[model samples]
Target: MSTIASLSRSWSSRVPAKRRDPRCAEPIDVREKRYGYFPKMFVHRGHRYEVYAVERCWTVSRRGRRDRIERHCFRVRCLEGTFELYQDVRHNTWHLQRQVD
Candidate 1:
């Protein structure tokens, strides 16, 4: 094997992999800011998480329909860890998208 390839493999092996669940669509209850609709806290599976900071926020539009928003996604940081949460615009319900820890 090439020297660079071996070094890259070694580096990757030493770093811990991030666990992610892309299909975690479980429903959640979220409390958001009154005006801008930013998530401040959420409850999932009987556990409550208070969002300390919003890392990222974006809207997912429907395929072939740019004007229509399907969901509002937020990557937030809480006391336990970072998590991806989203709100389904059509149903007006919240969901825990994934855990990034």
Candidate 2:
């Protein structure tokens, strides 16, 4: 059987354009340290990455509705590299925004 890592690599390579484009944010699975606050780890494109440190974090409010949050953004560092991840509060879904470095 092919390993998950290998499968992820193959799948990612098949769609290089989408994977590389910052504009195309993809869905991801995230595990938060706190109940719903800080991200501890995340999986993107079938690859798991542990968050080493959170460089920055912020929340965006829905337009014309400051009381409602739109999404929560986090810039995090992992063993492989740095990434920007975000959680859509309204939908309660996570996405891999971009690879910072």
Which regions of candidate 2 are displaced past 4 Å?
Answer: 1-23, 32-35, 64-69
Residue-level lDDT of model 1, residues 1-101, one tens digit each, is 99999999998787545323345478998855535688887888889888989999999877645456589998999999998888889889888877778
What TM-score does each of the candidates earn? 0.69, 0.68
Query: Once model 1 is optimally superposed onto the true structure by TM-score, how far is the C-alpha of residue 7 displaced, in angstroms?
Result: 20
Highest lDDT: give the candidate number.
2
* Tens digits of lDDT, candidate 2, 12-50: 888657546746888999855655588998888788899
Alpha-carbon RMSD, each predicted model: 5.1, 12.2
lDDT of each: 0.81, 0.82
Give me the runs in candidate 1 sitting further than 4 Å from their true place. Answer: 1-23, 32-36, 64-69
Model 2 shows how many backbone clashes?
Answer: 0
Worst 10 residues of 2 by lDDT: 60-69
